[model samples]
Target: QQQKCKQYMSAELKIPTPHSDCKTACILLGQSLKSDLMCQFENHIADFMDGLIEESMILEAAPVSAVFSSSLSDKERGKLRHLHPHSQGKQFISRRSLLDELFEVNHIRTIYHMFIAALILFILSTFVVDFIDEGRLVLDFDLLVYAFGQLPLVVCTWMCMFLSVLLVPYNLFHLWCQSQSSSHGKSRLCSWLFGSVYLIYQTLGLGFLPTYVVVTNSFPPASCFIIILEQVRLMMKTHSFIRENVPRVLTWKKDKNPAPVVPQLSQYLYFLFAPTLIYRDKYPRNPVIRWSYVATKLLQVLGCLFYTYYVFVRLCIPQFRSNSLHLFDLRAMVLCVFNSILPGVLVLLLGFFAFLHCWLNAFAEMLRFADRMFYKDWWNSTSYANYYRTWNVVVHDWLFYYVYRDFLWMSQKHFRTVALLCVFTLSAVVHEYILAVCFGFFYPVLFCLFMCFGLMFNFIVHDQRKGPIWNIFMWTSIFLGQGVIICLYSQEWYARHYCPQKESSFLDFLKPRSWSCQRPLMADS
Candidate 1:
């Protein structure tokens, strides 16, 4: 009926009816483009339907290939029929449209797998709970706890390996399917980064420490280095096929085509060591990666120098001899702070920046790539929002996909704020666990609570009109709250553990205009 509507519209507006020459073009354009059609026409009911009636919209939409299949003129459909060869009863769907529906639009297989995984987890958890409750799984509490605690890590490792090999290749195939002209340098880049990181970590035994005692009761060489190297070797072979074939499999227009595949392979390798993919889509032309990498290495060297200086001061210099030693008073601690935080943070920040640079560049490339090859408007009007979302998307993707998405799905519309609060709390709890493992203290829980309240408050009651000021206030409150708790908690721990009097009040430290700020000796003293 859309055809009738177009005719009605033409008559009503006194515009000439579409020429015979344009009909084939219109049909091809309509059929080849589905997303743009839906995005443009989803809300318009008049063109779509009426009660108990499906209206014929236009001359049956035909494929682009069908339009160009025959030498016949647009005035003759009968002559073109033999060359076109499409069945009259069948509806045409673009190959891109079919892949999109299966993988992107519907996510049918993903949903099915998730359901199966959830059921298995449920059953296992139930059996474990029952076994523990009945005392049938007999073991000492510590051993049992340690073994059970590893379950999540084991499951995560299994899933990562599965997805790395299976889902990654599947995503690569989608990239191949979508790339009509370009050789999909971006997709290959993503695979390289992931593969490189996986290999590096695996070679390092994922940062695990193992001890082996020799005959002389001396420590054996660290096994972690060997494991990591082995994993890296495996990964190289696993990715060899993609490394060799990607450039040849896809075609590209000459000007738009990438340099010889070797340079492209090198670029992918660069990203593998230090990912450019995250921000590559955002800022492909930027040289921030090289400078950032240099700066990080410089900081690491500086950190090592500081550490050596600290050791020299403590061991070689006399204690309490002179104020001349700036080394012990402040320089040592400054060095310690740098040694504590900078190396890891610098690497993380570099990754974050790379993610931003790559994502925007890739997105821009994607738009141009789609426009030149597909000749369809697949890019969303909310492209800016999408760019922001993809910029440093790895962590947020995990948060949204695993936690927030599931929380929202389960809760529907009810208590969304509460569900979000729980998610924050859960994140905080995991962070606290990590903190406790690294440092022999349970004090990080207070920081976790601080984050929970801050996130919940900002999310539930944020005011857009005062967004900047509101953000400042929220951040200040969280920092101050955490700072106060940490200070008090540390002082309390010190007093209880080392300071003579465990019960001294703050007032006792400031009594009766005492010339000495130090507390008086205890009665027993």
Candidate 2:
């Protein structure tokens, strides 16, 4: 049958095809046998001819702008395609990370081994120092202990916030849906009352409770971080759940005899723990949880914690600890900034790997969440715009889908730049808020860079500028930016410690003391 099909093709083409070509044609013909064979063959021939003509035209019209524009359009389309909503009840398969898939490559594995070796060396150096100084190899973990102190309070606060988020939003949504379904005016009035009361309750539970816990308890940086981070996570989860389900409820109101499209409690509970920020009725899930993989990822997270501690102790503390503020000059500041670059970059990388990779992946494994794309190859980004979009994909997805897209909808697709600026502003404010709450200071170092310099870089160095040079520039900017943050924040932190204010005032609290701080002469001597 295959031979006959190939012979027929050759005869129709009025040519003696090669034996290998005939075999290929026969296979293609066999694959199309379920359809109308002649019709498929004719369609294939037409498509081939059309492609040839299109290629000829493209070659003739080969202008740089045209080619570049076409490529950019393709890239933009690919990104936009993912923005569309996923089909309900459809599951997707997750793809492995680039490094994970490339582990078979010797070079990739070698890099991983090198990082482990460096960690081992750091441990050895610490032990040697301890033995030499204290006459015994005693490892002190006071820093770690202090950092993670007051865990019970943090856990309790988080549980309270989670319960509010889990109960309030879902119940309020149900009330709203039921009111819409009823025709009676009393039902609508009751729904409005319930919603108003629920909003106030949420305001207290989600907003006031977390802030009160952080401020009233005088929680340390780590403890405050837990409350703030959980606060943000729960808020995003609740918003996503409502944002996704409200449209279905609205549609259900218009129908007469159909049941409401209410999602299950189990599904919402699973979503709360999933390693994603987007809400859907269903999501891609793995068939089974790999306990070994989960264990490995958790171990990596622990190693990263130690790596960060060492980075601060060796690289940051030594430089900032004993510096006399009176002797701080332009040259000294420059030196400090340059000295911090390496440590800052290390912190950035470690944080990315620790939280975005290992931490998320571990939770994903335990929860069987198959979509493991918590981040992308943001290090390879040639522009800040690309970097921001690719850096923390979980947060980016939330911001894009909820904030930016909603803004666009409100503006009726006009003023795209305004929408972009809104995203930048929201991100910068949240980041600065986190820093202020965690460190108990109002320094706007991160805010200035994120809103001002970051916004400038996003526009100036865009996706259009492609090449190795742009990539190098982007990385250099990142290094310098990180250096600035570390240098200035560290200096301010030390200055506040050494130079206690004579009297507390609002201006004094907001003002940076680093610029004016002066160490006593006897202390300096």
- Scored by lDDT, the top model is 2
The root-mean-square deviation over C-alpha atoms between each candidate and the true structure, in angstroms, is: 24.6, 7.6
In angstroms, the error of model 1 at 80 is: 39
Q: Across residues 88-110, which tens digit of lDDT does each residue of candidate 1 receive?
A: 21221212211123445456668
Consecutive 10-residue window with the lowest summed lDDT within model 2: 64-73
Off by over 4 Å in 2: 1-93, 184-195, 255-257, 501-507, 520-525
Task: Tell me the spans in candidate 1 whose CA falls farther than 4 Å from its real position.
Answer: 1-393, 410-415, 444-448, 460-468, 485-525
Reference-based TM-score of each model: 0.30, 0.83
In terms of lDDT, the poorest run of 10 residues in model 1 is 371-380
lDDT of 2 by residue, 175-269 (tens): 77777766768766876787677668757778777988897787877788889988878888888888888778766666655778888788898
Q: What are the clash counts of all predictions, listed in order?
A: 30, 0
lDDT of each: 0.36, 0.77
